[model samples]
Target chain A: MPGLEDLYREIILDHYRNPRNRGELESPPALRAEGFNPLCGDEVVIYLAMGGDVITDLKIAGQGCSISQSSASMMSAAVKGKTLAQARSTIRAFRAMMSLHGQALDGHGDGASGGGGTGAVGPEEDERTGAEVAAAEGVSLGDLEALQGVVKFPVRIKCATLSWHTLAQALDEAEKGAGPD
Target chain B: MALNDFGPPLDVARIKKDFPILDRVVHGKRLVYLDSASSAQKPLPVLDAMQRYYETTHANVHRGVYQIAQEATELYEGARAKVAAFIGAAAPAEVVFTKNATEAVNLVAYTWGRANLGTTDAMVTSEIEHHANFVPWLQLHQEKGTELRFLPLGEDGTLDLDQLDQLLDGAKLLAVTAASNVLGTLPPVRLLADAAHAAGALVLVDGAQYVPHLPTDVREMGADFVAFTGHKMLGPTGIGALWGRRELLESMPPFLTGGEMIRDVRLDGFTTNDVPWKFEAGTPPIAEAVGLGAAVDYLNGLGMSAVRAHEQALTAYAMRALKERYGDDISIHGPPPGSERAGIVSFAYKDVHAHDLSQVLDQAGVCVRAGHHCAKPLMRRLGVTATARASFSVYNDEADVDVLVDAIGQADALFG
Candidate 1:
């Protein structure tokens, strides 16, 4: 009986209606990356100004459904001032939380700690990998934790993660010392 | 009953029962299928016919003097006759069986276009055509150096006939769809046919979306060629037909010149068979054609006029219900109320990606199509990446529409 109303929370709706930091940053020292969801036509362009290990500035410009755009808005805010290591750690944690494998991050002695009561696991096992990736990386991602609900809707998972994937792409480009764009 | 009312009133519930695949659960709920635009569900009669053909008449047609070969040839030609009658063609010889509508369009482009079109020749189509209709013509343009033109659509999703006059000038062929698979807009086919004829252009109607819901008569439409698929019309996959005027078929070169399509073959040259056989090369989809024939008989028994009426009523009800429930939060594409249109309704819910909407609907066991519907140019015209579409058929009713409306309302409440 869980409905779409449960998926689109008021905060998500607000971000979609009144999108924050919704513009492209000019090219310079920033690494920019673009991600596209072919199924939904959701696209994201992430700009990251990395000052050594720390991300000094981050912004996103994209057009997509509420889930994708709001997820991007939330993503830009979360990674703005984090160090490169911290950003990767936070992304791992966030991905883990969304994949409902946060128990792996909880470290309850058992190496195979499953995130119980998360209701994140679905019939599709591929989703569990997202959680496994997050568990592998060490960070604590909260609030964005709400996106775990996306696992129940497989198609929406792409929308919720388009921005994150773009951010990951940006970081990859930064590591390579190449412009993300 | 009169000859006009040759068919019986469709027992929709019984027909629905015949489709065993329809009686299944998806996402832990009863499946409510609404994606008939992509492909239609098979009925028991069509399925049984195909099974019977494979069981009894399983042989390569037109070669062996064996009993099975004769039976197979008879059944295959009979299927061709049924297809010809289904579309109101004068004879079975005018119907050429192809793999599907895409291949049918390709056949025209490769054979007809290559033989007739020159650098000075032109091909005209609309923006709303499915890629099957669009790409083949584009390939023809590339190969023959022919000019390719498109009839622009108005804001309301209808073709601008005023623009059509200009595009049709000096055009050799007008390849257009009878109904848009995405927008659900039924173009003015008779009008376009007349205009193309006046401009000295032969018309090829892509009836892939149209044939499934409405009754089609090639003579009445005055089209030179009409292409459609069996799968979309409650028939088996891998079978489709291209109905062309007898003269056109005779004049056009063979599409695939091999095997049954040939009369005599020498080391240096070969002679092709007559009319439909000349175009249908290799081993045709014999069993699939048999199923298609049964499908035609089934639809004829149900009466196409009634089917058309039923869908129109369902579409109107769906449109009214969607507007009432969601107001402007949902954007419905295609013709307005009372205009000639199909049961396909393509739209995007405010702030929700079509895939997201489809997921929400799938969870509710309400199936629909989410993507460009193979009309990328039409999607660009509509200024959206994709839209979720729910198309109706004879099997669909008010309850089906309610499922779609309720699902959309749920998506709106969840994502808005």
Candidate 2:
């Protein structure tokens, strides 16, 4: 009950139903990145338009479960119109949340935070990338907090984080003057 | 499902008692495990076999002359014999052990595929394969330029065998799954084998899903290679077998070269060991093999026909119950009820993504796999990204089906 209530929040379902910034951006001028949750075959492709330090525009495209699609939808909204540094901070915070070793990062201090994430059994715990994402440069997870419920279901965390991780990889690639292939 | 209802008198409660994990509680309710297509729950006999082997006969096999070592060697080879007999193989020598069915496929991909197949020759497989059969061919096609062809799948999840001959033209091998893990569709293996033989091509059956549920006779199936895993058949993980024709195996080169697989190693070159051992390089899974033998014994005791009958009834029950309950809200894939199929039932509930559906199910202690079920190309073919799969085993009863139906209703209510 602790994790499920938050996991499938109404807002998250709404985002999944009608994702924001959904689609592909034209290439070259707009760099593209891709991510996949091999466990569920959830794929997320993000296109970034970087104008100076700010993200001018971004678009997300792929098929996946509610946590992933909604997370991508929420992620696209969170990063768009934000500076590259702020977006990068949010990625770090998200990864921290999904990290395996418990209490590694502050869990944004919600009421459910006291007894959050019962943790899925066996060999899969290591696969949970951001178990309890603690911090970011005050990027404020905001709508992304709906995904905090994914912590209890360790495997689904990968689904929730695919786009953000892909965005991080894209940003890193952008710095190297190479777009994600 | 109330134990007194109309169903098979298969002593499911006793069967469930065999698996220790069946008693586990998830989310404060009895765990109704429905992910047997992914992996089956090992029974106490299998567990005890491995435990006993580790405690008593723990030694490096094939190297030592000591008592415990001999016992260990006997156990490891004994598993091969048991597995061969279970699948109705000609000889134990035909069974080559690997890590899992995936590794078994890789073994063939590296050894047989690399040696015999090339650019000019083609390989035909189905889209319904669990990447084990699909990816290797794709890799062969890409890296070695082997012409790759797929057996077109029907909308009902059966193979479109009409294209078999055209696809098998000039093909050296036809790889296919005996049963689709996702859709629960049982392909006509013997028929496909005949088609492949007509085209002068060898057939490899990925029996990972089939061998566990069905009465598998490799010779009767008429396939050259039958690959399956121990874990999926109620044994421990890290043990799978590739039952190949002795002539083909002897002809093929070794996939993994090392200690046990070789007869003699010189500075210049090395001579390989016997057929199965030649393929099984290094130290094999000793205790795991013993466990596999016990699992085989367990299956033999149950009788494969009875096991198949029980699961078929359960599958048919699930189909009728789900349709009766959800109607058009749920769409079950695979051949309709009464058609030849196995235990797996993969379905989609309207717009509720499989992950979300499974999550709600999980809350009610119903365990099911929610994804492409490792057949992504098939998933694409079916026009869905993911599906919730409920697979049955020998232990599952009408009670389990009742729990699953209730859980689905809960998910539907939540999403609604």
Candidate 3:
């Protein structure tokens, strides 16, 4: 079984302590979308500045747990300069990583990052985690790979996915030329 | 885990054995279930009663013409009688079966609320009500133009009844919860009902959290309508009761009209059935009612007073234990010491979100609910987005509370 170290990687904690793009955008040029996870009252309001097909800038405004808050922090950093299609694929791949099939160990990623609490399934687990990280948007998930442990806890998947869903909504609103209403 | 630490004189181990789920392991640890406020674990008697009902007696009631059908009808009505007696209702005819407490509230809102309350009339409720009770009244007020009044919740998690009379002005109905699922605060339903009566308003008590934990007598409460669910009281799902005054139920039109809720059906129109059946439409939850009857029998056997005392000891120990262990790192939300409360402990940890706390706790096999608890208005009033809740049941003892404390400490360390 993967230890608790997998879920609480230092990179995830660093992101939680210092989130990127944490604020609101003006409503005129940017579209705002609000997302809610009723399970734990984790809410996110994503403000997007879209210049044609690219997301020029974004801000994260909400309060939640480490998985949610840090995920929002990493999400804002990852999608700031990506095109609309890339962001959508990242959301789908992140959802795939969070999906549970068989009972598996809980961990963030491989031993290469820093932690040394790997057990019997170290290589196989890291390889699988690496595959998930590599597959998300065809780019290294970096800090986002720390959330691989979330699949072991089904109830917290909503926390890890709230920000991405909200970003998707913001993109939807940005395309429609309407407010987040 | 060796000895019962919740208190003396109660058979805590034997009671734990009655619930089959307690013996199961979760995530390689003994399941320390503290989410009873969401739904209590059912015992063997309730499960057996349901299975027996299906195996021996399964038929459409009130219209069959066989020995087994009569036996099924007898068992169904017998369950209703048991429910009526369990809550001290005036008669068996006064109890109406619905899907759950939420449905019971909807029945009153649609049948009584829409027909009588409008314009100058108002429906007064409190901020502490579950959405099951709050949303229906809010919808009525919006659709019918009725004024809506809400009693405020104090900082200490109790209702501010100082201005209750003033809030009741022009209100035709006062619907409120008997207990808070989040704060575990037990409001004075009898007092509230008396004041609402003096202001010429009928009272509807949402007993979803009360009937399962406390000794309930609707007449003693002086509320005209009492709603509660069976699953919260160790019965199966799909069964709940709405006990209204016979006269009040008679005056209101049937909420649902169908096979069982009607007396006779003609070409153009149909006459409704009797008081209880008038509210019950189509095939009711017969097997679930049997399970509820067995649950009532089980509670009666254990004695409601004993059950209440056991939970009181457990909750008090939990509150003191968490505070003594964590000090200011944790804040338990509820009434002050010496005040009567249910076994629910809603708490918040310093600088940690409820979702995170719940996630870390689940790693150690501690089950708790982390969210608004379906009471968003009250959550807003409390000024917190959400709270982590640990609710006790008859099967829980101090061991469970100890496990919660250790798990929370682990979570605190991880966050630090």
Candidate 4:
């Protein structure tokens, strides 16, 4: 049987026990967004400092189960100092990596600089594009990639995605130049 | 059955068989239903009674003069008698059927609040009331400018009645729950009633949670009005009763007027029907009432005292087993062991989201409720947005608790 050792990896547990970047930024240059999972009492507040097209800094603070808190910790570390375009691309790559059937990217391109991509593709084609994009971008998702195990436990998916959703909302707000309270 | 015979040490297996739905599967696993505080599964007798009523004596009650209508009316009124008797009301005429307990509480708020409460009048309630009980009074407060006071809950989830004397002063009404749906804390109803009465305030008991597991006598509790739903007590949905003192019901004006609730209607004005019917307007849940009567019979046959004892044992066992396994990691809400509490257990496991916990339990075929439980104020008071709750009934046993504990153990492994 799968155990906590498999899901709550040492790094994940460490983050939960002693989380980094776990407080609100004072008068943040970027927008702040809050996300809550009503069913589980999981809550997260994302703070982003944006400079033009780039995310200069990112921080997340909240209280929730280990999956949610650790996921937020990892997300804060991964998305900091990345551009808006780069952040969106990384989200797509991360989603693809978590796919149970090892499916490929659908609409997103294979780490190409510009937008124009193929209309439709098979599952294998999508996987190839996802892998090619990760390699080309040299995006080191690192321990953040361990969240692929979360898909197996469908319940924990919400926890893993809590920070990502908040971050997405915060980025959207930052793009609009409106602070999300 | 004798009262002594129906005391503690109930037969849980036989009780489990009485509920037909307990035998079914959900999500390809045997259903370990622990959401009875939300709504209970109906027994065969209640289902059959509803079916028989619809099949044999289906007609508009109290309006038609035909034989079937007379029979339907008899059964409907007979069900009122059963409800009145069930709650130890002084007379059957005091019981008014409503769609559900929410409607029952609203009826009292609209009727009694209009008559008794002025701008200066105040209503005292606890934070533990379900939204059904809380919202109507809140609306009353909004409309009439009545002051809404709340009794605080102690850390153990029981009401801190030490301040009841101070809180009850100048209050026009006190609406409280007999048993909290979330915490399962059985409040001091009789004492509260006495205190409220002494303070010249009426008392309304929300019996939605209590009537299922325990035997309630409204008169004995000294409550002026007691509201409960049939669905939570093994009956069909869309049926509940509000038992008020006869004089109080008679003094209060009609909440909803039209149809069978009237005596005479004219172009200029209309005269209302007598007592309970005046409160119950239009076509009521006649068949649902018959089903509730059958449920009462079913429970009476098993004996409510036995049912209460059965749930008490199950709750105690669950508390002990869960504490032994999880220790401080699992925080159990409500009264401590040996305290007077119902079967519901609201809890949170450290670092486990309630929804995730419920989903894990669901996968193991152990169903429980995971949310704020319509007690947002209580949830806020508890400092949690949501909690996973496992509520017991006559049908639940130690084995069911074992399943719940096992599921939680599995969840611990997943989130540790």
Candidate 4 clashing pairs? A104-A126, A104-A127, A105-A126
Stretches off by above 4 angstroms in model 2 are A1-3, A99-138, A173-181, B1-9
| Ranking of all candidate structures by their lDDT, best first | 2, 3, 4, 1
RMSD per prediction, one decimal?
Answer: 6.7, 5.8, 7.1, 7.1
Local distance difference test values of all predictions, in order: 0.80, 0.84, 0.83, 0.81
Give a tens-digit lDDT track for model 4, residues B97-145.
Answer: 9998999999999998888887998889999999999999999889989
Q: Which of the predicted structures, 2 or 4, would earn the higher TM-score when compared with the native?
A: 2
Kindly give the stretch of ten consecutive residues in candidate 1 chain B with the minimal lDDT sum: B1-10
Higher-ranked by DockQ: 3 or 4: 3
Better of 3 and 4 by lDDT: 3
Tell me the spans in candidate 1 whose CA falls farther than 4 Å from its real position.
Answer: A1-21, A27-37, A44-59, A66-128, A131-181, B1-11, B142-145, B256-259, B264-271
Comparing 1 and 3 on TM-score, the stronger one: 3
Count clashing residue pairs per candidate.
Answer: 1, 13, 0, 3
Interface C-alpha RMSD after superposing true interface residues, each candidate, one decimal: 2.9, 2.0, 2.6, 4.1
- TM-score versus the correct structure, for each prediction: 0.82, 0.90, 0.90, 0.80
Query: Which ranking of candidates, highest DockQ first?
Result: 2, 3, 1, 4
Docking class of 2: acceptable
The Cα error of candidate 1 at residue B168, in Å, is 1.4
In candidate 1, list every pair of residues with a backbone clash.
Answer: A4-B414
Looking at candidate 3 chain B, the ten consecutive residues that score lowest on lDDT are: B1-10
Model 1 TM-score on a 0 to 1 scale: 0.82
For model 1, the local distance difference test gives 0.80
Tens-digit per-residue lDDT, A1-181, candidate 2 = 3337767788888898889999888987889887776677788888989887788899999888888889889988988998877887676566556553332221221111122342222332333333233232566777877777777667676677667667876776566664344
